[model samples]
Target chain A: MKIGFIGTGKMGYPMAQNLLASGKELFIYNRTKEKADPLAAFGAKILGCPKEVAASSDVVITMLANDEALLEITAGSEGLIHGLHEEGIHLSMSTVSPKVIQEIQSMHAAKNQILVSAPVFGRPDAAARKELWIITAGPLEAVRKCHPIFQALGRGYSNFGEEPARANIVKILGNFLIMTVIEALSESFSLAQRAKILPQDFLSAINQALFRSPLYENYGQLIVKKAFSEPGFTLQLGFKDATMARDLVESYRVPMPYLDVVYWRFLSALNHGKAELDFAAISSEVFDSWEDHPPLK
Target chain B: MKIGFIGTGKMGYPMAQNLLASGKELFIYNRTKEKADPLAAFGAKILGCPKEVAASSDVVITMLANDEALLEITAGSEGLIHGLHEEGIHLSMSTVSPKVIQEIQSMHAAKNQILVSAPVFGRPDAAARKELWIITAGPLEAVRKCHPIFQALGRGYSNFGEEPARANIVKILGNFLIMTVIEALSESFSLAQRAKILPQDFLSAINQALFRSPLYENYGQLIVKKAFSEPGFTLQLGFKDATMARDLVESYRVPMPYLDVVYWRFLSALNHGKAELDFAAISSEVFDSWEDHPPLK
Candidate 1:
């Protein structure tokens, strides 16, 4: 099968590389085209646009930026569907909203193309490890057909049965948890430093107890070392997902009062123009919450 | 060495039992006399109050609730100091504020009483396994004196050195991380369920990846079951620690905006009078955030 990848940004680039490294017949396209060169060196055939990639591939996987980009690539007249074969599959791994996934699923179904929501959880490093946990939802038959691709890009995959949006929802929820860890670690660590708690002791203690997770360890290491210069995941996306989650809950009359506060924090970062930095910069925001600390890194 | 045990409630009782079973000469006291009986049967001396326990032991171990109860036994004329010898050492294992630990240190100094902040990490069950992680910060000599007792109550103890509040601060930060996980799990699990994502699959998928940790396995079970009945650490104390963290941050002039949201979820549980329930009851708060599906028990 010829595999085409859309969105060659941070995660997409490495994922595409892994697919090509797996010796699969792979094609790639990026809106900027510049992102295609790195993968081209990895022997991936860089195509012109979404439609071209979609037309030649059996499965086109998307790891786009956000809802707008996802909608753009999947919904236009010359979008992915314009080129997909009736038996083709569109596997979306982007952390998108359920509604968007549902819409994409509906349109793909109309064209006799199958849409599979296969959102994976991992940072760029984790993705590089082929260690992402893929939560798949959509047609089970479609998912079965794409098992080889899932194996190419990730370590493990779980079938969420059908309902592709359900996979996206889980992805969003995972993001929500990540943000919460980032925020909580930021606040608590900052508090500890201010109170003169030794960092070696602090990190070792939390990591051993209720924490003891790579996500917490990953975020805690960054916060403890005050490393936010080059971000693996930008603050803007963190803010974006939180806002998406907040909308998801509120639109359905679900009262995510806590998420409402998290959304505001994300907006606050956007307001302060820290959106382009690492989400660990939320640590700086947390530090600012205290009256005594100067600011975050 | 003679061991003094104070605050025999849920946690203290088990911890004291573990110590007494280890064959130490135990002197026990609790605000309520009835709590003293179980241990009293095992060759443990049930002292009437803080003063009595202090006068009779070389080392006094306290495992009270919040900073208030912790202080009540360690402060004032009728407190631990009234009976502590010039050479006595007080080992504090309660989850109290770094500030309070500092205050206790000051009070202990006047009586030449050594204060060791040894806040523990792990639930009551873990405590019984002697599987709890104990963090110690105080004089090296004082820690040496309490090493035997630490061995009895926990699998191992890590020394933080000299500044006792630093250990308390580490404990607070650890709790902060736990709360962050709780709140995040609550939000994501609830949202995922509404989006047709089977929260179990969502959690399993995430937990299998970066989200995997004993913290998730333990607390995630509570949030997933919506069974907040077990009160290892009540929502009330959860809120207290969060606020304690917030207070430290605000006092330090740090900005912890994520906590603003978590505090409210905790407040929601508190508002609904679920403060006495398990901290995982924050699940309801997350459930309340989404309105599409009614809710799952």
Candidate 2:
């Protein structure tokens, strides 16, 4: 069965290329058509929009940026929901609000089209390596049908029950966990630096002792070096996920005491002109300018 | 060189046992001597007090509970400092305040005795396994002299510098980071549980995805299971460390915005009668009572 891929942004571009390299029969579409052009040389058929891509393929995979992008591509006047064949599957591989996933699932259900939420964990680089962790939920049959596509795009996929939106909630919750870790590291680095202990030293101590994770090693170094210019994940998008998590918790009537702190740290990072930087830039929001303090150690 | 091991608490008991098992001549002391009796089988000699332990050994290791214990053991009438030999070294293996460490260092310096702050990271079980991470700071010569002792007691050690108190600061900061993580996990778990996502599910997703630290895995499981009865580190000691961090940041004029939040979480947990519970019990502070909500997916 032919597969159509949508949204060739940082994460999607590498992910889609990995599928192409795995020799999948592919069709592609993006709002900025040029982004999809690079994949065309690798035997991917480029399409004008989601509608054409859906009409041309058995399964259409979308890795759109956010809620509005996913909504527009799937439910807009000339969208995939209007053109997908009977029993055709739409595999959502983007991180979006669970509520939006539920709405989109209903839209697909009305026409007897299958929708599977298969959001992923990892940055763009991990996507390129096919090391991304894929999370899936929906009808078991549809998930099984899309197994080959998942294998090509990610290292593994975790199935979280039959509700497509459950995968979305897991993705949202996953990002919320990331932001919380970043905030914790930011606060810790600030405390370490202020105490005449190098931020890197404090990071090394804990990391060596117990926190032996790639998340700590990667973000801990970025935070210690104060290097936030490169945007693996922008602060703006990070803030969006935080807001979504806050909304999810509020709707459920659960209290997340530190989430507000995570949200505000991202908001404060944005306010300080860190929109284009990596979310690890939130460290700046938690710490002051280094020059203001005398040599501590 | 004869080694004196004081404060045979949960961590210290296992740690001292390991040292004695490694064939070191050990003189042990504790407020309640019964705690040290277990070490006698491994050729450890019981001493009357910190003063007697210091008098009988070339190097004294004090692994007390807090600043007050360290201060009382080193500066009180029957303290270690009074009995230490002219060139003897005091290897403090406790989590205490940097200010207190500095004061203790001064007391040792006045008596022509050397002091090295060599605080550790790990729970009681890790200490038993000799997997505890030891962090040190003081004169390089003293640190070098105590290298064999550090090797016997821990997996590895990181020396900060000649400033003895720097190690204490690192230990305090490490505990602060752990509390921050517990607070973050507590908040995130509440959001996930309320959102029909099980806390264990949220934990599995994050642990599998990014935050795959032992810190996240261990405490995440404990918080999810609501198993805070057994104290790896008590909520009271966690609060003391948080208070120490707050004081450190305040003294250094460094702003740790989320530290106050952590301090309050621990304070609130204490207020609700969780002083004896594990610090992961701070999760109880972030989550509402189980009766207030129905079972979530």
Candidate 3:
């Protein structure tokens, strides 16, 4: 099967490489052509636009940044919708809003094509290791055709049935859950520091006792050492994902108060010019917020 | 060493059983005398009051319900502070506020009796199996002397140094973190249900992909099944812990917005007559709040 890949950025670059390693006939495109050029060494054909890539391949996988970038490449004049053949599959792997994905799915349906939402969980390092967890939903036939592709890109995949938006909602909620952990850790660690407790010691005790989750341990260590200069997922992306969650809950008129708190923390992190730092850097906002407290003996 | 075990509730009973199993000379007490009667068959001496239990043993372990009960047993006329010998150690295992523990610590300190905060994590079953995680902070000599007792009650223990309140603060923060997960799961599951996604499927995917923590799996299962009748931890106790977290954050003047959200959820759960239900039943509040939303097709 021929697979066209778009948006060869940090996460996408490694994912696209794994596709080539799996011996699939691959075509690629990127907003910056140089990022796609590296794939040529692995026998991938670099195309000029999303439309051209879609026209040449049986399946096109998009791993874009956010909803805007995803929609631009899917519905733009030089978009995948303009050139993909009938029954072709557009597999979206971006962390995007469910509403937009539903809209895009209907547009694809109108053209006799399929849009499979398969957003993934894992950072770039996990992507490089092909250890990403993919959540997929779409027509069963289309999803079945993409099984080998999913195998090449992820450690495992869970299908949320045939509604494409289900996968996106699950992805958004998963990110929302992760952000909540970051915020919880930040607030508690801030209080711990004020109480003359070492942040590392507090994290050690809680992680060992309650969570036993790498998600908690990784974020806890990042917050403890104040390591924000390097980012697995940036504050900008975190803010985008948080906004997606906010949009989702608002659309359904369901109240998710925890999301509101995390959303504001991400916004505060962005306004303080830490957008390039790791999303876990939001702990800095939490720590800074408690500056007025007198240090304990 | 001779040990006194007070409270004899669900958690205290199993813990006291383990202490007796480890062959320490045990004295047991309970507000309702009948509750301590069963332990007498296991080589435990059923005592009349907290004072009698404390006076008979070298170490007294208190595992009461909340701050009020703990304070009543520690500082009241028939309290451990009055009956314990000059060098006796008071090991507190209840989930109470750091402020109350500090107050009790000072009272014990005046009489040269050591107060060690050693709050534990695990349900009644974990306590019964001697699999609880213990967090301890007190004077070095006192903590070391109680090492065998901690081993009898827990799988492992982490020491937080000489300040007894430090361990209490860590325990509060740990519980606060767990409550945040419950709130996050509740809100997301509510959204997933409204979107026609099965809560079990949503939980299975996220737990396998993101958390991989038993804490998430257990609570997720409880919220999914709406199984609150047999609570591992009651909603009333959950509310008390949430209140303690609120009090801690307020006293330190630190902003913990996430705690504010969980605090209100616990309050709503209690207000709706869910005090006897499992703490995970707070999800019911999330579901009920969204009742006005028209059912999805």
- Report the number of the highest-DockQ candidate: 3
Model 2 chain B worst lDDT window (10 residues): B288-297
Q: Would candidate 1 be rated incorrect, acceptable, medium or high by CAPRI criteria?
A: medium
DockQ (C-alpha) of model 2?
0.52
Screening candidate 3 with a backbone cut-off below 3 angstroms (N, C-alpha, C), the clashing residue pairs are none
Candidate 3, residue B115: lDDT: 94
**How do the residues B111-179 of candidate 2 rate in per-residue lDDT, one tens digit apiece?**
999999999999998899898999999999999999999899888988899999889888887887788
On the 0 to 100 scale, the lDDT of residue A173 in model 3 is: 92
Best by lDDT: 3
Off by over 4 Å in 1: A32-34, A38-43, A75-78, A198-201, A288-297, B21-23, B31-34, B40-52, B66-72, B75-82, B97-100, B239-271, B285-297
Ranking by TM-score: 2, 3, 1
Can you tell me which runs of candidate 3 are displaced by over 4 Å?
A292-297, B292-297
Interface RMSD of 1: 4.7
What are the clashing pairs of model 2? none
Deviation (Å) of B118 in candidate 3: 0.3
Scanning candidate 1 chain B in windows of ten residues, the lowest lDDT window is B288-297
Winner of 1 and 2 under TM-score: 2
Assess the local accuracy of residue B115 in candidate 2 as a C-alpha lDDT between 0 and 100.
92
User: List-wise, what DockQ does each model earn?
Assistant: 0.49, 0.52, 0.57
Cα TM-score of candidate 2: 0.96
Give one digit per residue, the lDDT tens place, for model 2 in A74-183.
99987998879989999999989998999999999899999999999999999999889988999999999999998898778778878898888888877877777777
Native contact recovery (fnat) for each candidate is 0.75, 0.62, 0.71
